[model samples]
Target: MDPAVTAAALDDEHRTFARLLREHQGIVATVAASYCRDPHDRADLAQEIAAQLWRAWPNYDPARRFSTWMYRIALNVAISAVRSAALRQRHAVPFDERLHDVADPAPRDPQAEQQIRALHAFIQAQAPLDRALLLLYLDDRSHREMAEILGLSETNIATKISRLRQRIRHEL
Candidate 1:
């Protein structure tokens, strides 16, 4: 690709990424909150995910669903952020009682908030891959979408979900 042409394409790709991110802000927020406990860390991870999404936009195929691509990038960035000990050590922040701001506007019940907090605590205890599966499950994604986002076969997604269900049931 010519230098000027490449720059133009990159700019166009970033514009597309920005529009998609706006359309799917909920997905970003969900992934960020599900992956991190600290509010500052969640914000940082969300920003990193957006930056990576923009950089990876040129590789995205227009025929594919943008949400699928965004989920993959967001989850990958989130997973990496959790794995990077140096990053965590350097940017560690205290998590206060106030939960990270979710976009919910409805008057939330105390019981519901407590339940959500409990669920997040349980999810935070799981392995990285398991956390990814639970996040997709919580999002009500179908097996095919989950498989696509996680790069697993549909059968694998089904089996893992079944196990997750069993575990959740046992916990409840």
Candidate 2:
């Protein structure tokens, strides 16, 4: 309970949190990009995700997989951002197309680029929960893992994945 010992422990905790956050930083970026179209919004969402993760760090169980824990927090923050944006936009006027980000003029493979764009469009069109499911699926997460991250049953995850695949095939 000495002050020096307490400071050292706090420093160690901060270091551990930083290391874990760096190790799984991609989860934050991917979730942010998946939910936000604008670059600024994506950065904001990523920051929020990191902050929330740090805030929740003391409760993080070392026995649990860090990536799994990171995904849950990242996805939750992204979903909340999407919901908040939707709520704000509901009563707002539309913006001009000129303000949107412009696409690159030259795609290495036009066909592949088109497909990627179509897939992203499809993902963005989904409801928030479905979007999270698709992101986890695309990331090659197992049904059990997805269920753990999203707080759903493994059976429900499998069923939803099957339905999502059918929808993707039909629509995209």
**Highest TM-score among the candidates is held by which one?**
2
Clashing pairs in 1: none
- Model 1 Cα lDDT, one tens digit per residue, 64-103: 8888888988888988887899666754322222434445
| TM-score of each candidate structure, all chains considered together | 0.81, 0.86
Error of 2 at 113 (Å): 1.7
- Following a full C-alpha superposition, what root-mean-square deviation does model 2 have from the true structure? 4.8
Q: Which pairs clash (backbone N, Cα, C closer than 3 Å) in model 2? A: none
How large is the C-alpha RMSD of every model relative to the true structure? 3.3, 4.8
The segments of candidate 1 whose C-alpha lies over 4 angstroms from its true place after superposition are: 1-12, 88-101, 108-111
